[model samples]
Target: MPSADCDTDHRFVKSKVRLSVKVAPKKRGSCTRKLQVDKLHELSEEFRRELEVRLDNNEIPDQDEDPENEWQHLKTILQETTGEVNGFSSRKNKDWFDENDAEVEDLLKTKRSCHAKLLTYPNVQAAKAAYRTACSTLQHKLREIKNNWWLALAERIQSYADMGNTRAFYEALQSVYGPVNQVQAPLRSSDGSGLLTDKYSTPFWVAGLSTMGTFLVTIGTYKSPPSKTYPNRK
Candidate 1:
């Protein structure tokens, strides 16, 4: 009889060996059972090292094609399975995955199917480019909206200032003035004036000047009549 380990029970089945763990009998809870070598690839030293590296990085090693990449990734993970086996065994196998290998393979098969389905969509790189374009457009519109808000707020503050509302004047100053003001404000400081400086009350300023010009032209035309003295001499 082969010697038995104190922590385990072993038996032979169909020329294959099986091992069951013996837990501390004094424990109150249910004992846990585990298949020691749950995967097939773990049986091979070369594949098991690859699996460890992939798992540590959470990334597959680069492959030339998408399908190949998927396959390689799955192959690395498949190390934990026994080949050509449908049932699990508690015994550690140097060659095959425990009975749970089939389940793990099935899960991987489902994932591969899902990934293949995603491949039917437009080119992923192109999709990302389009997404970036849409994001940029949205950002531009948001900036315009913000600028318009600033213009309205500035107008409101000017109205309050006209009415001698001291609080509103200060609050208006604290609010944003937006892009146009950035260069204009500094230029105004240096020159003591700015381009279209009277734009703040533009409508009133323009209308008054236009009305004055029209009135002056009308008066000048009326005062300068046709040459009546030349007609009398003729």
Candidate 2:
């Protein structure tokens, strides 16, 4: 049998071996394509037809059915139908930048690889030249990508404005330039006495204004009969 020292050494070696093995992280899928509006409409229609058929067959759960079972059935129907659709997998949210951004990313990766090669062969003139060229190309591609993105956004905003869609135009504006900060009004009474409180609510202010307006309007509307004789004597 192995001695106690030998067993302790074996355990240490096993732990060291386990730590040396590095587990690679799982990679997420890329959104290479987006679903078109027409394709989305088609999917909606298909789902509606399926739901109608289920209703006709009396397959829908009633109020007395278990909530969990009802939810599971609905989820199953949606998932199965969506899986059968061709464009569902590629559907992703729209990005601020267009597809050219992907090309820019690929160019940046190439530039990084070229830089690595230059570092590996520090004395090689060809490696240095290649790295320099990659850097130049990457810069040019980045400028072009940004120019195209801004142009596309400007065109969208202009189109929305021309169509008289102020809401959409503002939405596009906010997306590109970010939201504007709103100025908060001071919460004080008309006389600038103090901050408004529950005792001096908006209705209280409105009622006071209404009473003042009524008094002003009726101040000289009715004249005393004696005032006519006093004006003649003057």
The true-structure Cα RMSD of candidate 2 reads 16.4
User: What TM-scores do the predictions have?
Assistant: 0.22, 0.48
Candidate 1 lDDT tens digits, 21-94: 78866757775544334454445675456556657766655665688777876764553432322224442212
| C-alpha lDDT of candidate 1 relative to the true structure | 0.53
Worst 10 residues of 2 by lDDT: 1-10
Which ranges of candidate 2 are over 4 A from the true structure?
A: 1-44, 53-98, 179-234
In candidate 1, what residue range of length 10 has the lowest lDDT sum? 91-100
Q: What does candidate 2's lDDT look like per residue over 1-234, in tens digits?
A: 222321121322223333566888879777555334445565687767865675566465456578887788777665555455534434233344445767877987887787767667879999989988988897787887778778988999999999999988887877776557899886666567665677667766787789999998898696767644444564
Error of 2 at 159 (Å): 2.2
| RMSD to truth, every model | 35.5, 16.4
Error of 1 at 4 (Å): 55
